[model samples]
Target: MATAAATIPKDLSRLEAQAAGVLSPEALAYILAGAGDAGTTRANAAAFRRWKIKPRKGRRPRKVDLSTTILGTRMPAPVLFAPVGVQTLAHPEGDLATARAAAELGLTYLHSTQAAYKMEDVAAANGDGSRWYQLYWPTDDELTKSFLRRAKAAGYTHLVITLDTTLLGWRPRDLDRGYSPFLENKGIANYTSDPVFQRKLVAPANVAPLPAGIIFSGVFQNPGLSWDQLPLIRSSWDGPILLKGIQSPLDAKLAVEHKIDGIIVSNHGGRQVDGAIASLDALRPIVKAVGNELPVLFDSGIRTGRDVFKALALGADAVLVGRPYLYGLALGGQAGTHTVMQRLVDELETEVRKAGRRSHRSLSRSSLIRTP
Candidate 1:
């Protein structure tokens, strides 16, 4: 009889292929497109190939230990689900289904600020599983405070402040499709539930109908946010806080000075600044700058178990996968997400054994070699 684990899909690329089949061309392109020339996206993948792993000979590998602890929480693997909003476009169940899959897999799932379901609903789906909330930092101070309070109350253990997206990127795919999910009220969960957002509307004297599309436009941008305001966020939350878009070493040093718990080396998956350094290329210097003072997590261009291993070897304590699992969700909703997670875990286990390492601690800088 086939074991339960054996029945799950073993190839992540297969999930990607399935996603390609299922998702509309516009949806697929919207999620996959990078800003401007898209050179950074291609560069991210190429950087991984430049580094080659040097395997040892005459070593016997018996068991692999993939379990790791991040931000004081134990996870079965070093992979975390990166936040992707407006999942409803791919599936009816949306973020709720993705949350359930993450909970079952013992991995951390970061819920996006622009999620389809409300934070509380995603939390309910998580049901005691480790979760982190990503915040967009609204332009209004009161509104930002309200969101922070609600996220904490909703059981999010970590607060990921996304510093990358002050405005939407010039995504040609989305622009060509004339697709703006926000304008259609697709990924506006936090906005709809916000108290300050609610206040913008003039309620009828005797319970009259609300005005048309007035609430969304009022709470969209935060032009005045500067580094000075970060302290207010720190004051509001009593949990681990991470600054998510640090690509430069100097910024990494500044984040450490702020006493933030962690920093994610990201380029918003190449969706923010065109021609920004590929995140993988930027990881080494940032890790060196922090110099063991803070935990550095990496994202962008992480698609396979080999990529995960390479990231760990390159000083990333953990890695966040964005489009790969989104592909999974698009292909089969909850089951698809589970399949993608399992394939990644399996590949990591296999690679760990092949590398002749017993645990993550043993696989360090010495375990990797750069391709000439």
Candidate 2:
């Protein structure tokens, strides 16, 4: 009889393969797809290998401090669940299971605008856990305000507005299967449940999938969105605002100039842009631009503890992990999600201790050397 550990592979890649075996071909493709030829998606992982961690020769610290606070949220570790939508495809519980796991672990859970479950229900599932709301700004101002109001009332204390996905990317995998969960009303729980959105529906019968999906599609993206609209968000939600999807130092500088609370240096996990710069390669320059003016969070291509370590050394205050945990959720639901996160946190502690350091805070560019 083999133990669970003996049966399940610890390698993240193998874990993803296991998940692929469990998920439907359509679901797997949607979860795995990157824009166009996936050039940037591939680059995100490659950028991590371009640097080598430099271990200092000295007495190793017996304990490492992984705790950090971002935008007033106290976390046990500097990790947050990246807002992945349509989670029901991986598991029936979807965001509900992930929310519970985040609560148990005391890590921040970022609820997606396109979440499979309603925000209020997900919040309830999260219990007293710290949660941040990720908004995919809609075309309607009232609907946007409604989402902000609801999230705040539901106990979400921070606002993360994704800036890159003003328009959906040309995802070949999703397109190939003609499978967009949103079109099927799979990820529109937030919209369907919203009072503002409901009022826009011509009739109660129109609230069903086909009609509601059309309404959702109409307001989902605002490609004409501009910097001038930031004030609307500021007015609608009274919380720390973090602008995600920024990869350019100029944009980071602009975020500072706009008085935004923080910036997440990302490229939407390479789902938005095909040949965009790897988010890791973009981190240092953006951090250089922002300085200590605002917190700089990182995402995209973060797959391992060493990846988190590298991001911190390059100047990210924290990192948002996406694919790895979702694969865990696919494997064993909530327990698997918790296990994957714990492993990452534990590995991060190991990395800090082995490098002869005691805290992630002590890591800096000096801890790594750029490789050829």
Candidate 3:
């Protein structure tokens, strides 16, 4: 059965331009710009353009099905709102707007460990919407356990352990402007609200009095983190575990060996590395490594429905959208977020049908061709 057309402005380019008027210059540049010289950032979108779909003709009159299930949770599209932190910089409502929007759309949203609001509040906004918790893996064991415990209690269905960012990367754009959201205590509501983290607070906790790095350094990134520590998180979070930022086939295989539930093929949306390979370029091998064993959620370089379709064809079970919805939120709040996401789903279903595929799960490498 055909669904109604997307209600809001689905055109990303137009929506983004509209957002520029609504957001601050610092916020605008921060979300759009990438790391270092931004070569890999450009490459993410460029890589998609290099590949063309080999259209299959003479399809039957059957309608395409965009419905899919991940970890047994059924969704209307093979898409999820990726965990993008510090959303308060984009909108006052922050993760709450996102949570409410996802719930209304029946879409799955991954809540960031560093979200601006407390996890419980975001969960309340979700109101039975399927959601996952993305863990940054704080160095403090008890603190980490506290976060996991709260998420499980909040109705989060999965745990996404982000593994690649042991330390923040060199992003020239943010550096040039002396803009760091953490330093402002913008996205640490989850941490600050935590009883464990609050107990560690000393000399009073305020954004201006102390830099976030000073307080968060110990807990933010554990450079020494390795597979040895995976058990710690596993023991804490009993639900499904997905290790985000697995770019290599070896890492994908290792995750399977570690008995992980899924791996998000990402390069932190070209924010972590300067000259890294495009995430889509890295997806094929990782999928080849362990696509059958666990779900491979692809992130980075996804701006449109065609991008989502291309990622699905390349091997991702589902794709995560990062910045676009934030742009929408900047422009129109919860309604904007819903419109952008729904637009992507609308476009993805349109792409699946155009490529002559019945279901998104049926999309394969044969559906696309890499152009020279």
Model 1 poorest ten-residue lDDT run: 204-213
Estimate, for each residue in 1-372, the C-alpha lDDT of model 1 and write its tens digit.
Answer: 133234334665455565777788767777778988787888888888888777778685788888888879798899999988888877778889889999999899899988988899999999988899999887777888898899999999999988887776788878888777776667886777666776775762124223413455555556566789887897899999998988999999988887889999999889878877779889988888994998899999887888888888888988999888787777677877777777887888788788888876577767788875
Report the candidate with higher TM-score, 1 versus 3: 3
Better of 1 and 2 by TM-score: 2
Which scores higher on TM-score, 2 or 3?
A: 2
Clash pairs detected, candidate 2 = none
Displacement of residue 53 (Cα, Å) in model 3 is 1.5
Q: Which numbered prediction scores highest in TM-score against the true structure?
A: 2
Global Cα lDDT for candidate 2? 0.89
Lowest lDDT 10-mer window, candidate 3? Answer: 1-10
lDDT of 3 at 181: 79
lDDT scores for all predictions?
0.81, 0.89, 0.85
lDDT per residue for candidate 2 within 250-347, as digits (tens), equals 99998888999999999988999999899999999998989589999999998888889999999999999998888878877887787788778887
Candidates arranged by lDDT, highest first:
2, 3, 1
